[model samples]
Target: MKQVLVIVLALFIVGCSSTSKVALSEDRFLLTSNDPEYGYTENKPIELGGFLRGTKSAGAHIEYFEGLMGPNGEKVKVTRLGSCCEFEDKSMPFGGGLLDRYQLTYEGQKKPVIIYVNLYKFNKPLAPMGFALL
Candidate 1:
């Protein structure tokens, strides 16, 4: 019985860690907005949603970024800086959720760009201004 319980727990952990869901397409990923403030600001961060699907929050972040490219359609590398800016949300634990921040760099970018993402609520992911959809 103990062995069975251990195996079950291990399976659960593996399942939660895998990012099995593919992100939405570029056209469907971002909102049609030209303002840089749209995704740069934590107040209006890009929404990745799908948090209730049982996958880990970090996995969702990676999944979404996989479908993105640089402003000039260049391949971009992303690093998760960390989580910040907690806000009230009925669907999230303790009635709030935190936004995830990422640093994006491309071949020609002079400086890395910081973008915000939300996972707690389901919102249409918007392609940030100055970013190219892949």
Candidate 2:
């Protein structure tokens, strides 16, 4: 009986443990959130279109932040963190692409804010909420 109980406990522990880790870039369980936050300020992102702007690589991302400012006209620094949230699109031959996530930091702010840019498609983007347009 003692040996049987030990085996049962070991099996239970092994069953609870996960063998694989969930990757940050996993596309199997991604949320499709294309809704633009035009009214509210939360999760506001500037639409940076590369194909429409005739740009490749990070050129379009650079142009979007060029001459852009913070809420109080503070010089905003744009940093390309990486890409996330892949989805299907007619623009790409593979029918899928990822949005580039940028880290925007400027003076007089608590910390930094992350902005998502969709460079695959072109849509004239308005100034992001709480940002000053040049």
The superposed Cα distance between candidate 2 and the true structure at residue 34, in angstroms, equals 16
Model 1: weakest 10-residue lDDT segment is: 20-29
lDDT of 1 by residue, 14-63 (tens): 98754333344456435445776877998888877665667445355556
Task: Give the deviation of candidate 1 from the true structure as CA RMSD.
Answer: 13.3
Off by over 4 Å in 1: 1-32, 55-60, 91-93
State the weakest 10-residue window (summed lDDT) of model 2. 20-29
lDDT of 2 by residue, 1-134 (tens): 99999999999888765322222232321222234463123234455566444455436656557745665556777788887777677767669677777777876679887777777665555555666444
Q: Which pairs clash in the backbone of model 1?
A: 29-125, 30-126, 30-127, 31-126
Per-model lDDT: 0.72, 0.59
**In model 2, which runs have C-alpha deviations exceeding 4 angstroms?**
1-45, 51-58
